[model samples]
Target: MGIYKPKTYMVMISNVEPSTIHEAMTIPSWNQAVNDELQALIQNHTWDLVPVPTNRSLVGCKWLFKIKKNSDGCVARNKVRLVAQGFFQAARLDYHATFSPVVKANTVHQILTLVVSRKWKLQQVDVNNAFLNGDLA
Candidate 1:
């Protein structure tokens, strides 16, 4: 008889995320994720659920989910965000200004250049999300 080998089973994982609200609701852990998102929004004073104005147009909102993990390839946290669908926004009409916190490559280079010129140590740090810290009023 030939040498016997043990059977091995492997679990497959995909980067694909949920696309619909119903799909998210079906998962037990997703409920906690949704609740955590709402809590953060409320605590951050993100918005108020008031009656829609008769003469005002409001954009639609939806929940987006992401699974974040550390370097060890383990589940770190569930991130859920409420995103506004503003594709219909008109320039200089619906809104005058849009804000984004994306960092520019030039800006990063300049900052690093300054630190190197000054012979200062560079330490990575995380800052509060600008969207959350800004005054929406």
Candidate 2:
């Protein structure tokens, strides 16, 4: 018999998520995702362009990049979100109150249990830019 030879395997990794806008703009997928986010914000009238007030502090914003994946570990899409740096604002100086509308896990479980016991039909709705739907003032 001939000398036995072992097979070699190589793994390649790619599609790294960019950490900055400059880096992201260079990639086509990330660039498109950024454009999509801007378009959505504009179409929804999320904010108005206004001159900065001399007395009020201006809040800075940043672009966050994320790669959404499918259940099978395949990349679904490039997601970009523009978020304000709220930490820069002082509590009493910047605004009056802060509130987060979050549902408790126990409440969700109870609702699901009730629905299951009653054999009720359940429909799920996914709202894109749900945060933008809220009124700012």
Give candidate 1 misplaced runs (Cα > 4 Å).
1-16, 97-137
TM-score per prediction, in order, is 0.57, 0.66
Per-residue alpha-carbon lDDT of candidate 2 for residues 1-137, written as tens digits (9 for 90 to 100): 99999995543322688999999988877888889889888897777788887778787889998887768997767778887777877878875433333344555576778889999988852344534444322
Local error of candidate 1 at 31, Å?
Answer: 1.3
Instruction: Give lDDT tens digits, candidate 1, residues 18-77.
Output: 777778766656766777677766786766678976755777778887877668986655
Which lDDT values do the candidates have, in the order given?
0.63, 0.72
Q: In lDDT terms, how accurate is model 2?
A: 0.72
For residue 78, give model 2's deviation from the true position in Å. 0.6
Q: Which candidate leads the pack in TM-score?
A: 2
Report the alpha-carbon TM-score of model 1 versus the true structure: 0.57
Question: Lowest summed lDDT over 10 consecutive residues: which window, candidate 2?
Answer: 96-105
Q: Against the correct fold, how does model 2 do in TM-score?
A: 0.66
